[model samples]
Target: MSTIDNTFEAQSSAGVSGPATRGSIIARLERLPANAMLVRARILIGLATFFDGFDVIAIAATLPILIGKWHLTPWDVALLIGASSVGQLIGAFLFPWYAERHGRVKAIALSSGVIGVTSIACGFAPSFAVFFALRIVQGIGLGGELPVAATYINEICRAHGRGRFVLLYEIVFPVGLLASNALGAWIVPRFGWEAMYFIGGVPLILFFVLRKLVPESPRWLAERGRMSEAADAVHAFERTAKTALPPMGDPASFESMVARHPKRKMSDLFGKAYWKRSAAVAMLWMTCGVIQYGLSTWLPTIYRTVYHAPLQLALNLAVAASVLGVLGSLLCAMLVDKVGRKPIINWSFMLCALSLALAGVFHDASVYVVAMCCAFALGWLACGFITAYVYTPELYPTSIRAFGCGVGGAWLKLAAIFAPTLVSKTMIGGNLDVAFYLLAVVPFLAALVVQFLGIETKGKVLEQLEA
Candidate 1:
């Protein structure tokens, strides 16, 4: 047996007798077939994720209007674009900590409520200052929702096809982005920018749905020594299984595994075993964040200002790019298992870099040319960006998975904050190309980080990979 399997065996042997040992819980969960319950869980969680995507880019769709309405300067625009990310950074740390302690379902529900309430408040904001403040508060919820959601999604799946399952669900996020852009084109011009915020706030209702429908992650429950609850959670899936479950191994043998490994401190993410993984994933999130936010969040405004596209046309162009982004995420969801996480991420980042470089080089070309180039770049980055969500949780053990994802999420929020400001500063001298050129460097550097530092987790069980 390999070291991980051997250690698992040893731990199992040492475990106390229990009806649902950690080993049995994992085995049962892995053995359970995909069923209606699983589908329901994905849908419930995905609804929240979809709205997270919607709210993220809704500001982009509204920005052109906000800029004109407020007579905002570039700095004000940057702050407005970046305000949510600042709050998200705080949430990235806070909610994951909450998830680790309070349980994933509660954390997700609470954050969703925060997002829903604050987003509605944003719709009623009378001035730029109020809207910005509301966004920051809403961001606290937005930031908390994703990483914890990602962690929750990652924890529940079997390792074999986990990438496909998780990424397929994650595709809803880009779809949400696409929906916001597409709807923004129709709604903002017709109903007003306030309508978008009101629509985005609709996720508030999802809070109740999630609390009522989804059970806690059994893996997390097992790790926390809540074996009976974990067993109950597992049995919920077991009841849904169309095929008979494989025999769960000796219960006592697996029960002690959690005790054997013990829960890790948050600092352990930067400690010897995990620091490199932490660094690489953090870099990946930042690279993806910078490209995604710097480009997607600003694309409409860029179209309106730099390229002189009509308002409707600007939003429409952004919707086109978002369509490409959703397609790219779907492609990643399909290919990640076969292609392996590291290769897809590494190659996609390089391709994104190439496209961005070209966009920068020919930035002075026709608007169609620049928009198409940026669209392609966003599409390619979407591939890597979606994959990062699948890969980040695999890097750490269950003990700190949510926490690790939170730290990585923090880096993403930092990038979100930095990218807009950087783009705004670069746009001051009509140096739009300079922003693209700078963004191009980030993914290229990230590609190297992945090539050198990232581990392949494709088809590997999370515990074994961490071991």
Candidate 2:
């Protein structure tokens, strides 16, 4: 039998704990079902993610006004839209590495605090240059919080129900994006674009609740060999035990997770043990970025340029499309646990590619707009975008979970940085089909990658995945 099969022990807890083996934090957490503590943690994390989602699409939400007032050329449009994403690399690479060494809680707190300050500053920028710099700062905060937060949420969830649990909390991100689009539709046109920034800045105050509300991931603590700290964190995450814990070993003998899964060098993320998983996730991230980001940031611009949509109508259409995006994301959150990650991701990406391709072939403006709406729904709800977020962190052990997630996120941001640039160049005049056709190929490929390479993580323990 494989180490994975031997270590995981058939996923049955026997519905009771002997208190001795219960001493292991992983055994303790896995035994319990979801309860109040997890609920509160999700709410707290969801609130931060909601704003992160809001700020992520905030530029796109207000793109019409930026293009008009600033006289932004297509190239300038790409820079303005992609600037925050440029800074995401730093947040994605740096903070999660820090979290691996320091802790998940502190990393999240500091990152959230940075987002708050930068968002408020963005509201008052004097020029496009100042605004661009402010966005980079905000992206830093945005990038830092997500991967670490994902690690904490995933670790605390019960293995049987982990996908639904984590993805449900993740659903807030799209809702935030939808809300930003709706808010910008109403506020940016009448009240001006700064209103969007001001609203985003105000949410920074919620970051305070994170430290007091959510506990560190016990799995992470255990991986670090801080067993006592892991125990305390498990207690903090679960106020009461739901069932019997695993059996402890004889007093003189100890089973060692550290020995079984030896410490991987930082460089090993690209080596034999993890490279396939990493490549699969990275490719998924990039394709989702191209498919989703390419369309998301440019939808309103596409609406105006192609159909000659008026400002209010353009924003209104963008808001309506986001409604589909939100519903699709919620659908993904609901089905991920039931349907399993690989099948859902495979089919979703296939549908996303089909939608984009259909839209590309039909040159009619009405067909194009409706096609985009279909693509948004299929991609956000089922395609590998939401699937990737829930699946990527599960692939690595806690030692590099955050780093793995961070790199996955960084690739998406890097794609976001380029997607808009690519779309901007082609979206002018009647070349819009070029952008759609370009974006379609990757999602189709992503579906195949998931089929062959994506691991089924729906009900598996985090540690068992690497085993």
- Residues 1-467 of candidate 2 have per-residue lDDT tens digits of 76333233322233323232323566667666546677777888778788888988888777777777778888888888788888887899988998999888778888888888888888888788989899888888898888878877877876787888888888887788889989998888788888898888755676676777777777777777665456566665445445444453332222344346777666778998888788888888888677667787787777777777787777777777777777777787888888999887887777777777767777475834654644464444344677777898889887888888899888888998888878777766557777778777888887787678767888876766774
- Best-fitting candidate, scored by lDDT: 1
How much lDDT does each candidate structure score?
Answer: 0.87, 0.75
Which RMSD does model 2 reach against the true structure? 5.8
Q: Where is the poorest 10-residue window by lDDT in model 1?
A: 9-18
Error of 2 at 324 (Å): 1.8
Question: All candidates: CA RMSD in angstroms?
Answer: 5.3, 5.8
Clash-forming residue pairs, model 2: 16-244, 17-244, 17-245, 20-248, 21-246, 21-247, 21-248, 328-381
Error of 1 at 390 (Å): 0.7
